[model samples]
Target: MNVSITGLTKEYGKKKALDAITMQLEGNKIYGLLGRNGAGKTTLMQILAGQVMPDGGEVLIGGQKPFENQAITESICLINESENFKKGMKIGDIFKFAGYFYPNWSLETAEKLLEEFSLDKKMKVKSLSKGMESALGITVGLASRSPITIFDEPYIGLDAAARSRFYDLLLEEYEVQERTFILSTHLIDEVSRLLEEVLIVSDGKLLMQKNADELREESFIVNGPRSDVSAFTAGKNVIHRKAFGSMEQAVLYGESKSDARKAGLNVEHVPVQELMVYLTEKTKGGVSA
Candidate 1:
């Protein structure tokens, strides 16, 4: 279930949502799709899940386009932030309908998740609260067991406890099923540990894509006297910097830990959230990473 996107482009009249983006994603891995608001995260996910069409380029799942294709659509399950369940449908009915469409659907998992989330099968879609609705959507995503499962900010109204449960369940299912999971969320720090790879988009362009571990390792923060920081950071890619009189702290890339130590500067690992903040900051009207 590998996914390949080549020169993908999309627009809405005068607004360009995506611009000639190209990337390949391997199956059976967890990916964190990261972007700021209006950065085309939703558009990209829609295009990948076959719910929308790209104006240019192609998206291939297992070497075939997903749009309007029964086989591919059935194999990919995308749970969005806001689910639109039938007004009159019950939780049981929704599960039953999903089981029919998904070849790998698991009734047992669905039932267990309902109990864990404290949702009743007899409950009508209209009666469930926001958190309950999100829980149901997550249940569908996990129980579907689709080869390509995508969750686009699916835990909107979930509380801390319920959200923790969802994370545990996701990892449990992934360990057993080994399916590809693409998680798009604003809670970067909370989910950073779960990501194997990361993709960042900004202003209709792909900014960066890298393995989570290597990205963190290669990204180091330097702090020391302002003069020492300035001398050490010369010729290096400076992602971010802050100065307060004689003290200074800077975020840099492509600079090794040994180099920082040799320059008599303090080096520390940058957290995923901080890294994203500095990497995505607007510079000269363009996002830099």
Candidate 2:
């Protein structure tokens, strides 16, 4: 489903968790909601899922407000990093509840995932390990078949293999069902390939929203002699720069890679993870990409 946010603001005591953030999320695409700790990624996802209300502005999902709206929220599933399920509940009961709560819940898919993750429905929530719990969360989030499914760092304790499996399943589901998936995770490099679009937030404010491919093509790293790099980067939007003796390297946004190469500097595409770090660095004052 399409999600629209307009001047969305949220505050807690003296802190503004979200500050006049405005963006639009198109339907049936994978989005990376990236930011550092306490950057308002969680708060923004909560508001979109109808779990939290904004102090100012609004969030519209599929042309309707999600806050306290059952019809709207029923199509949105948000799996948080932790505290997703009650410890007292059994796995079977949790699945049953999800079946009732989400109109598009698929028990068949859930059962298959349980088998793949080696989770037994008879087990109690408190008895599972952290990785198992995360697996369960992934199963529910995927099986819900919600039009807008948001996963906020949902693989907390999973090993590398398990995380890879989750990524495969997420992509498979997306290809088959074509739903909107907003993933808020710190593992940017791992998930970067799956992201069709990227939304970056910094200090509770919207920094930039751009197509992933375009961002990759526009932002790059250049390295060469200090004088050569400096001359090439002159008047350019350099988000980051460093010097190693006579050699220097600079990360630039919205610059032509071909032009940099012509200037005798080594040009390389910046990984999304590294690009995010440069864009949100405090020294840069959250420069927009």
Candidate 3:
């Protein structure tokens, strides 16, 4: 389903959690919702899921407001970082309830995932370890088959191997099912290849929303002598810069890779995770870059 947010604002006490954030997300594409802690990533996800109402503006799913709208909510599944399942419920009970709540819920997928994750249906939620609990959440989130699935740090306690399996399954599901997936994760580089587009939030504001490939192509690091680096980076958006003795390296946000090469500067692609860090640091004035 298509998601449209217009002037969305949320506040807690005197602080704004989200400030007039406006963006449109098309259906059936994977999106990376990225930001540091306290950057309003969670607030925006909650509001989008209809768990919290915005103080101003609106969120529309499939052209209808999702807040208190069962039709819209049924189509959206948001698996948060914590408090996903009740502590007292059995694993089987949780799956049963999920089947009823999500119209597109697939029992076959759920059962298969249970065996794949080595989760016993009789196991009570409280009895499961953190890794097991995360696996269960992943099972439900994927098997729920909601048109709009939002995973906010879904692999909290999962090991590297399990996480890799989850990534593979996610891509498989996306290709076959063709539904929207909104992923909020700090592990940007790991999932960067899977993201079609990215929405970056900073300090309760929308920083930038761009196609993932285009963003990567436009942003690069140039390295050369301090003077040459300085001249090449002049009149450009420099996200970060570092000096290595007489040599200097600067991260720039523009399509100037060829120009840098022409200027006898060494150019390298910046990983999405590093780019995010540099961008946020620049925004927060953590560095002079």
Q: Put down candidate 1 lDDT per residue, 1-289, tens digits, no spaces.
A: 8999999999999999999999999999999999889999999988988999899999999999989988899999999898657768999999999999999999999999999999999999899889899999999999999999999998989988888888899999999899999999998888998999999898788888889988887888999999999999887788888999999998886568898999899999888777777777887222334
Report lDDT (Cα) of residue 210, candidate 3: 90
Candidate numbers, best TM-score first, in rank order:
2, 3, 1
- Judged by whole-model lDDT over C-alpha atoms, candidate 2 comes out at 0.93
Q: Of the candidates shown, which would achieve the greatest lDDT relative to the real structure? A: 2
The Cα local distance difference test for each model comes to 0.90, 0.93, 0.89
Tens digits of per-residue lDDT for model 3, 1-289: 8989999999999999999999999999999999899999999988888889899998999999988988888888899887899999999999899988999999898899999899999999899888899899889999989999999999988998999899998998887688999999999988998999999898898888999989898899898899999998887788888999999999988656889899999999999898888778744322232
Residue 284, candidate 3: alpha-carbon lDDT: 34
List residue ranges in candidate 1 displaced over 4 A: 284-289
RMSD of 2: 1.0
Q: Among these predicted structures, which one has the highest TM-score?
A: 2
TM-score of candidate 2 on Cα atoms, chains taken together: 0.98
Question: Stretches of candidate 3 above 4 Å error?
Answer: 282-289
Model 3's TM-score against the true structure: 0.97
By lDDT: ranked, best first = 2, 1, 3
Candidate 2 lDDT by residue in tens digits, 1-289? 7989999999999999999999989999999999999999999999998989899998999899999999999999999998999999999999999999999999999999999999999999999999999999999999999999999999999999999999999999988799999999999999999999999999999899999999999899999999999999888899999999999999999889999989988998789999999898987724543
In model 2, the worst 10-residue window by lDDT is 280-289
Q: Output the TM-score of candidate 1.
A: 0.96
